[model samples]
Target: MSDDPKTLVSTDWLANHLKDPDLRVLDASWYLPDAGRDARAEYHAAHVPGARFFDIDEISDARSDLPHMAPPVEKFMSRMRRMGVGDGHQIVVYDGAGLLSAPRVWWLFKLMGHRDVAVLDGGFPKWQAEGRPTEDLAPVVKDRHLTVRYQNQLVRDVTQVSQASKLGTTQIVDARAAARFRGDAPEPREGLRAGHIPGARNVPFNTLLNTDQTMKSPDQLRTVFEGAGVDLSAPVITSCGSGITAAILGLALERIGHDRWSLYDGSWAEWGMFPTVPVATGDA
Candidate 1:
């Protein structure tokens, strides 16, 4: 399979190009509260050589009360500049939990209109397993400019999502676990309601991943979405508990050559908190 820098790159591809001057690797690891894994501490301990730590929580919109909403354009550009990541650089983001949170970072870069970004297939876990070179040292800081042409079409807010739900013209694909989607399990976060957005079809993110945590083939992915009752002809709005795993779904859609998809920035974090929006349980 070809490794597209704009989509997913393998460890082999990364190893061969590790020394490329224009390459920027990011350790964008994150986890839920109960996972008990410290992403920052783990990065400090060991990470891909020349990799910078991209803290999703810290780099997000601090002004938002909800969890890690999209950061403002100015903040995103400033943080990317501070990290020495800028225009003309090919960014490869990988997470500690295989492919968990890295795609979310990839989606964030796409939101900023930087299309030359990709998620590391199998992520840090596969790299470590393959005896790839890693280091604990921080990358050398250099001055770089990241021009922002933020693409609003790649992201949706609560208002847009609600309107789409009511219209039923667009497909809302939820990435949470089936249990969580069905209201059979409690949300990891407190004070949010169970169940999913009204008229949404459930396609749990893990179903799109292989046993090794790498994404499945494009054909396999197409089958997965079709099996989930998602109509490929309709526009898709991907969402999850806090808009993290939702990007995994978005990435899969991209891999399958579906360009008409957007991520819900607030996702269930904003949707579930509001009692005004209706929620549906027990499958779509």
Candidate 2:
């Protein structure tokens, strides 16, 4: 598997680079309310050495009613500054839930036009499983300036997603579970309609991972997307329950060198709740 610093890296790669002067590790752990796991408490208990906690909820655009929307540019800059992550730092983000939620933070960095960030493949679980070093002490902090060059092409609004769903020029890929995509299972959040987006293809984010929770190889990722009827030659828009797991699909697309993919920031959370947007039920 490719361990590109800008996309993904393995536990071995992280272990070797942990002591680099410019390296920064972030525990970007987040869990669903039903999961009963507290990300902050988990980090306090034990985490990768020198890793700082990056709260997905707190580091987001709190002004938005929706869950964990991308934070404002100024807010992001201040937060990263407080966290001692800034210009010229190589960031490695890992989540407690293997590879589940960390990619979202990585994508956020990319959205802000940072290129030296990556998600830790297999994440904290695999690192702990390998008996790597852990600690409960907090990291040393220092303020640092972070430059912002927001990349609008990496993000899509609800209006753009609606247009893409109507016009087949761009592929809309849903990363929710099959049951949810088919309207057979209820959404974890209340006040939302069921089913996938019209003309969207389903490719559950978990399917892109292996049993060990590490991502599949590049060829395997390509096969998964193609098997779901995605056109690699064209652009794609990745969506999920609330724009979290959608980044997993975006990461997979990046791993396969598919450079024309963008993420729907509102995702199903906004679309499902809006009675105005048309949603498709059953398999695509």
Candidate 3:
């Protein structure tokens, strides 16, 4: 049987399917300053064979004052074209630190209306541990005219999110760790509040992933959501410290066949920066 698109994958699943013609692997690695690892450098040192690097920072909305906002349709199309990511390709993305940044790439593909994408389970660490093939050589770049079809419904602005919070029409899922979500942990960035949005449910992005960094099965993922008081049938919005990991939740929701979901672009970084925005902490 085919695997569920949402939750996670095993190394065995990936090893056996490596030669599939439609499969397109990507190294979507990004790291925080404290981690002290360069994703591009790591990708250059060694990567899965035929895997290309997906630079999240380089491909984002350059004009937006917010960090790493979604780029315009034209810029997205241009970038994908340079990367040779044509439509109809089955994309499988992975990060240096397991599932950290790959989901953002997965979410990016979906936001552009491409659904046949998945995050590599366990990420590069597991792939290397299994003695899988690796390459220092970069893949030859080929141009493809990847067109963009924007799906506005899959995104939420801060204003809309605030409105939703008051109406209780949408459930907000915060992917930050418990400490950050509760304001008990210091934020990585300076001068920002540490709590989460009012009424947001804490579902750390790592919980959705296995020890090896692969996603869990759809049934397992559904349980995780329900446990966090998230009703999949209802409207959903994902947020995180800076809007990155939240995409992981968005990817999970998409994988589980829940299409009525969006990523809060500004996320806590913006919301917390402003004292006027409603901030709530503790178990609510």
Candidate 4:
């Protein structure tokens, strides 16, 4: 029932507003290399009615060696225009793995300076389980010019992260699971070191969600953060395997009205691969 379009929207809210002319629903499904699920193929098979597929990897910064870095402003504007998503449209992004990948897209939209976007609570699973309408037909296209004003403060680089870790000024929160954060589990990426940045706190993104895969209440979210020993009052920077799931933490932070936050775009993917930066193993 919360009408905060900048954070999240429930399945019921999306279902009720399906027909609104200004509403734009996007299927932003993506999986890690180990998941073995093809997001584009799945989208072609079935999707919410009138929902467009937002390819995370395809619509990204191709120049970077890293995986799915944010696309340039011109590229983002072009992509949105082609998809008929532009100014004044209220966007709702969802993914196949419930709350997994949608928040990344939501964060991307916000990073591009679009605030009228949200992630679908419980995502595609919840909608389908409720027997909501779905279709495979591609939506009719009508190009619309999308304005771009990138929010530089919303993203951080490895250099900035290194400085923060050294200075202990920002609360760096790692979204990787406890095992990964502790270096008890090997990283999925090859030739990368295990463990996390020094002075960082672990807050696995899944801890903030309910059993049904929907995000927990605001009070519950705050509890989860506090339980993880995170200082919510400090400026926060979220990170994950490849900078993807970290956005889930970013979204959770926003849900609780924590605005002074940024996502480390390189995250562990870049951090682990480099030898110049220091790494910490085991729970502190």
Decoy 1 TM-score against native: 0.99
- What CA RMSD would you report for each candidate? 0.7, 0.6, 1.9, 0.8
lDDT at 199 for candidate 1?
94
Q: Write the per-residue lDDT of candidate 1 for residues 165-245, one digit (tens) a residue.
A: 999999999999999999999998889999999999999999999999999999999999999999998899999999999
Error of 1 at 149 (Å): 0.3
Candidate 2 wrong stretches, greater than 4 Å:
none
My TM-score estimates for the predictions, one after another, are: 0.99, 0.99, 0.93, 0.99
Error of 4 at 240 (Å): 0.4
Q: What digit string (tens of lDDT, one per residue) describes model 3 on residues 1-284?
A: 14644434556777777888767788999988899999999999999888989988888999977778888888889888888887777778889898888888888887888777778778899899888999998988678776567778888888988988888899999999998889888889888987888988889998887776777777888999999889888989999977799988987786678878999988987898887888887764
Rank order (by lDDT, best first): 2, 1, 4, 3
Kindly list the per-residue Cα lDDT of model 2 for residues 1-284, writing each as its tens digit: 76899999999999999999899999999999999999999999999999999999999999999999999999999999999999999999999999999999999999999999999999999999999999999988888889999999999999999999888889999999999999999999999999988999999999999999999999999999999999999999999999999999999999999989999999999999999999889899
> For candidate 2, what is the total of clashing residue pairs?
0
Model 3, CA-based lDDT: 0.84
Off by over 4 Å in 1: none
lDDT string for model 4 (22-108, tens) is: 999999999987899999999999999999999999999999999999999999999999999999999999999999999999999
